[model samples]
Target: MDSSIITIFLPIALAIVMAGLGLELTPNDFKRVSKHPKAVLLALFCQLVILTSIAFVICKVLTLPPLLAVGLMLLAASPGGPTANLFSYLYKGDIALNITLTAVNSIIAAFTLPLIVNFAIQHFMNDGQHVGLQFSKVIQVFLIIIIPVCLGMLVRYFRPELADKLNKPVRIFAVVFLIIIIIGAVAKERSNIMQYIGDVGAATVLFCICSLVIGYFVPRLFGISSTQARACAFEIGIHNSTLAMTIALTVMASTTIAMPAAVYSIFMYIFAAIFGTLLNRYAPSVQPSIEQAPN
Candidate 1:
């Protein structure tokens, strides 16, 4: 596996997609923060605790290879992408909270994701397979993720109509690129997929459930409405597997490591849809206050 492919191409592709995302984003998106601060905080908290705990348990119990374990943890640590907002809309969640959460999560992810990934690598790979985090590689991550996103925001600030126009085309590209990447990954790894599938499947499923559960309920406990909780849960539950796979293949040069994220990318949607349906059935409708009610 070539480090350059993962480190360079993957980030560039994602950066372009994220820039498109930023272009569509507005100051109003960030301003929604005050409207649901508690919900956002709860969702973030649940995401951190649940995913980290699941990663630790999976590492200890499954006795996974160091690279694979760290990759799973990295996927866990990565935050929601714009697709989460779309999903929230489809699932009848609070889109406003979803957008706010996505924006905040992406910003925090630039810094926190690296720290969490490095920590996981250090902890799980303590045996000797450690591929140390080179500062140069971190710079690559910042360039790939952070710089383009900020630039997109600047574009949105300066040229709102242009930014809005690019949104649909960018989203189309995102879907196409994602499909190509997943299929290519699966086909490329066909030889090892059978061997590793059983090994990683159970842990991945468990981790996904944990994320969904914590992401949804924790916000409710904090007094956020169920709609907002649903948004947070789904947002927190979805991991940017593309980013994880890119890091694993490019920087880590470990196909074995990339396998978890590859597997996850396919499974998440199915599971999330099912989970969302179940929640919709069981949770009560959140009625808007009479004063704020629609006419």
Candidate 2:
């Protein structure tokens, strides 16, 4: 990618996409955490603790190249994308739960993303301290997520009709942007793209499978309803790779560390769809949806 594109344009484009996510959120989405404490807490634990630890073990066991390992870890650290709600709706999952999770996770990620990436750098990359998350970079990560999201929420709260109008287009743009980011990152590493995929592909695929499986079953084991469990599966399975890639290219300034997210984006939708199919087939016997999807 061109330096201007990566440095100047990427963040702006990503913020627009993120603001689109914000358009769908409201203050109530955050407050819903209290209403469904068990489900919400379980999902967050899987995202921050279980999935992250699994990613680390995969990196260590695979002995991926340092930057590649960090890339994988970054993907794991990322929160679920807005697409999760769409998939949740399609699969008869609790779209309201998905939206609530997205609302909360987006906020939590501001703090956790930098910490996880810094750890990956320190553990995987030897000169981690030099390229690590500094105070300014952490603030960049914070604002990049927080500001646009809050702005979008304000739009939703204040100008709801306009927010509703923006929602579909922005969501479309977000999907398109994900494709562009993957292509740009891959083109940047054209010569090594094949090797990079070979190294990280299995790890990404395994991570996706684990994410979908654990996302569903862990909730099931806790006796959460199947509808809600399906929501958990998709939310945990589909990551916001665009955010990961944006942080990598602009904030971390390393396309090498962006490779895992790039490759994972390719497999993510495929696996997510397949997992959705299986969930649909063996869905809960008598799950009734009382929650409506967000606009």
Candidate 3:
């Protein structure tokens, strides 16, 4: 809510989180994309196109308030996080593909996020109601999203031991910061928190289901293996809500625009676990290829 917090602390917190994500990545993760081109492309199409379209339709059909609609769009645009890899690992999905998707998605999101958020701002927010991510602000968003990630990758490249040492603590901090951001967003709008939930709850839930379904089924339809489909499901279904919330609050300067991500964060893990269980129970078995376990 405060100017300093939005302009200073929030970006710094998000940079730390992105850096932590980078600590887990390496050149190999990106290169792994070459091994499964169809799966990777299908997942990206689902994430970049289908999922955002679903969010838009849900918002339009649900008739969400402007800020809330934008918030949901922002959440849709965010990349997958490390948690997706963990979910894939837990449920016999291809964790390597998850890692690869996450790596590629994070890179793609740095550009697409700004474009999507800017479009949402223009379309959803009323004239003079909120600032859009125009040229300068878009540049700021790019820096906030990408620069720290590159720096962290550099750290991993140069000081492997330090990167390893900082990894867990930074991840812990990322989780803690996400909790605090959710609380702050809720507290800042406490009077309307319940109403916001009521407005966005069904939309977020349906969007999550649609994401998981599309992420999985679209690739399967294209002849992707079940394990890879599972990876796509989790990667597309579990968004980096921390990134969404940070951009909403710090870049957009609107708590109302952070509410969807806060609410979605609450729903994602529960829904992802359920979706994973159903897949595991019903889908035909394909023996998982032994890969390096997710750290």
Candidate 4:
């Protein structure tokens, strides 16, 4: 809410959260993509292309306001968070695939997010109202998203024991930070919060359901294994709302633009759990296989 918090603490918090992600990763995670090239590529297509296009269509169909439309696009562009792995593990999805996808998606998003956000800004916001992701801001986004993760990976490489020790605390702080950001964003728009939810609630809900369905079914259509399809579902469905919200508030400096993500955060977990449960219940059975560590 405060300028100081937006300018300083938000980025610092995001960096710590991303570094926590890095603690769980290594070069091997990225390399593992080669083992399941089809699954990985299909998942990427769903995340970067199909889901983003779906979000655009929804924004157009729903006629969301300019800022909120951009917010939805930003959320669509965000990579899946660590929670997707937990869901994958819980629901018998390929946890290894989840980890690999998260690792790769985080890396890819640094480039794609700026392009999508800039396009959304130019397309949605008119000349006087535009908030472009200029060079400096794009660098800020890159530093916030990429550098901290690299530093954390370096920490893991040099002092794994310490990295292990810091892992849980950083995760706890990440959740806390997400809660604070969502609360702050909502509070800033308290008077209009109800209206905001009324405006975007259905769009977000539909988008979430479409994401999960598309993420799973599209891969399955291509003959991917059920477990890997499940992994794709959560990977595409559970977005990094924290990242979207932070960029909206800090980089874009618009709480209105943060509303979609904040509201989506409220509904994402609930919908993801329900979708996972239904999938486990109705989807054809698969033999239980030993979970392999990512190579």
Evaluate candidate 3 by giving its C-alpha RMSD to the native, one decimal.
Answer: 2.7
Q: Poorest 10 consecutive residues of model 3 by lDDT?
A: 286-295
Per-model TM against the reference: 0.90, 0.96, 0.94, 0.96
For residues 106-212, what per-residue lDDT tens digits would candidate 3 score against the true structure?
99998999888778878888887856787887888788878888888889989999999998899889889989989888889999999999999999999888989
lDDT of 4 by residue, 8-27 (tens): 99989999999999998888
lDDT of each: 0.75, 0.89, 0.87, 0.90
* lDDT comparing candidate 4 with the true structure: 0.90
Residue pairs with colliding backbones in model 2 are none
Instruction: Please rank every candidate by lDDT, starting with the best.
Output: 4, 2, 3, 1
**Superposed model 3: Cα runs more than 4 Å off:** 284-295
Q: After superposition, how far is residue 21 of candidate 1 from its true place, in Å?
A: 2.3
Output the better candidate (1/4) by lDDT. 4
Clashing pairs in 1: 3-250, 6-250, 215-233
| CA RMSD, predictions in order | 3.0, 2.5, 2.7, 2.0
